[model samples]
Target: MTKAERALETRERILKAACEVIADIGFENVSMRKVAEHAGVSKALLHYHFDTREKLFAEAMTHSFAQTGTDLDGGDADVPAGVLLARIVRTMLPTDEELRQDWKLWQELWVRAQRDDAARHLAVDLYDQLHAWVGGAVERGVASGEFAPCDVAAISTLILALCDGLGIRVMLADPRVDLSTAQSTIWSAIAPSLGISPAFPET
Candidate 1:
């Protein structure tokens, strides 16, 4: 790889390490030294690449949701929008070992954001992406007559708030918080609000 590519890779490595450390521990407990150690890089190198811990954490949040970037940006909805929407809805449900780590990391970030402005900014960005995706879907649903003529923006914001709030609720509760059930419940609630039968499949 070229120098530029190598530098980018190293930067990503540091961010991932920082995210994992914060996930394993709490963000309040995280240190640049710890992240450097986790990345197997030197402290000087961490500072050289990111300059500050907040920047590293912010970049990590972006990297964490990189896979959803296209959809979150309101690009073309993935085919079979219902299935895609359902999949996105299920993002909060971490069933496997790997996903559980991602979930824990985000949970840590959320708690940290309560006090840290940088963390709060990251939280806002996350919700904004979800708003764009859900709002686009709602607009399309209205155009297709699948939903009643309603305020797409408001409904989208409501969906995001519900989804995000419920995720936090489940995270704090006992292990029995069934995310699948939560997804289903939200969908049912949304269907009626959009003037569709709960059983009606998306067009």
Candidate 2:
């Protein structure tokens, strides 16, 4: 591999490891040594990539938030309104290991942001981006007649807030609750407004 490629790979590995560590222990307790250990690299090497613990965490978290929001733009690309709304709804649940990490890390970041200006700014920015994206999907869906003529902004916020609350319930229960149940509940709650019935047959 080229030198640049190796550097990029190492950087990504460090960021990925930092994301998991922050989720596990949080920003206050997170240490450079711990991150290095988690990444399977020496402390010196970790420092070579990120001179300080704060830089390492901020960069990793920025990367994490990007994944959650950047795609939300949907780039004026023409997707079916219903499909877009469904996509927005689906991003909320944690269906895999990495997303689970992102979910936990987001909570940790929220608390850390309370006292740290930089973290706080990042946190608020991410939230606004997510809200706008979801709100846009709802608006488009309503305009396309995919949903009833209702208040899209309010409903989108309601849906986002519900997902947040449900996420907390899932984390507290943590694997004991089947995710399908939460997914179905969210779908059911919005289906009527979306002008569709739940896909599952009612007993």
Candidate 3:
């Protein structure tokens, strides 16, 4: 591999290991040495890339969430707004490996956010991104006459709140709720605003 490619690969490897370690233990207990050991790299090399555990934590949080399909702007540019909103819902489900990891990382972040200002700021920023993406989809749908007009800001925040609550339940493995139920509940709750059934419209 070229030097640049090799460097990127090493960084990804480290981040992956960091995610594993943080998911296994909370952020407060994660150490750079533990991450290095998990990555199977020399301490010096790990330090060369990430000088502190905080930096690694932040990057790992970004990496984990990225795997959750946060980029709603890409793919199937011609997709309808309702369809894109459903896609976002489906993506948030923790039914798969990457999403499961993302959910776990979110749990860790929540605990850390209570005690760490940086974690709190990061959580707020990430939620703002989600809100913006959902709001954009709502606005598009309204403009296209595919959805009824409503308060975009309130609706977006509601979607985020519902997702966060359901996601946490899923991550906790609550006996009362499964993926399908939580997902359906979210769509059902938001359906009145979107002018559609709770079930995802057949694509």
Candidate 4:
């Protein structure tokens, strides 16, 4: 690979390793040395890319969030907006191993945010990004006349809150709350507001 490509790859490896280390342990326990070792890179290289633990944590969290969903925006244009929305919702849940790891990292962030100002800001920023992502789909559906014109912001916030609540239950292995049930519950609550069927769209 070219020098730029190699550099990018190394950065990605370090960030991913940081996510796994932080999730496996907690933010308070994560160190630059630990992350460098996990990434199979030298400590100097890790420091070169991320000068501080805070910076590493921030980038790692952002990287983890970016990997949560499929590229819905690049998906088939012919798919209904509702289906795309469903797919987005599904991505937020701990439905697979990678997503489950992402959820664990989120859990770590939530705990850290309770006491750390920087973590709290990062948490809010990440949530804002998530809100915009969900809101974009809702706005598109309304513009296409596929969904009822309602408060897009309110609907998006509700969807994200519902997902967070149900996702925690699924991650905890709550006997009554499986992935399918959590999905149905969300769809049942918001479908009416969007003028879509309560049945979860097959995504």
Find the candidate with the highest TM-score and give its number. Answer: 4
| Model 1 Cα lDDT, one tens digit per residue, 1-203 | 99999888998899789778877887778899999999999999899988887788777777776644345325554454454445566664554445566677777778879998978888888878768877776777677665688887887776676666666656666565566556666678677668765542432
Task: Give lDDT: candidate 3, residue 176.
Answer: 80
Candidate 3 Cα RMSD (Å):
1.9
Over the stretch 28-136, how does candidate 4's per-residue lDDT look in tens digits? 8988999999999999999999999988988999999887775875767877899889999989999998889899899988988999899999999999999999999
Clashes of 2: 0
Reference-based TM-score of each model: 0.81, 0.78, 0.91, 0.95
Model 1 regions lying over 4 Å from their true place: 68-78, 95-99, 173-176, 197-203
In TM-score terms, candidate 1 sits at 0.81
- Can you write out model 2's per-residue Cα lDDT over 40-158, one digit (the tens) per residue? 98899899999987778779888887776345436765776666666666567665676778888888877878888988988778777878888887788677776678877677777
Overall lDDT per candidate, in order of appearance? 0.71, 0.76, 0.85, 0.92
Best by lDDT: 4
The residue ranges of model 2 lying beyond 4 angstroms of the native Cα positions read: 68-79, 174-178, 198-203
Candidate 3 per-residue C-alpha lDDT over 1-203 given as tens digits, one digit per residue, 9 for 90 to 100: 99999889999999999999888887778888999999989889999999988889989998877767655647766788888888787677787877787787888888888999998999999888888878998898899988899899999999888888888888778988788888889889999987877786533
The residue pairs that clash in candidate 3, if any, are none
Would you list the clashing residue pairs of candidate 4? none
Could you tell me the lDDT of residue 31 within candidate 1?
Answer: 90
Runs of candidate 3 with Cα error greater than 4 angstroms are 70-74
Task: Specify the poorest-scoring 10-residue window by lDDT in model 1.
Answer: 67-76
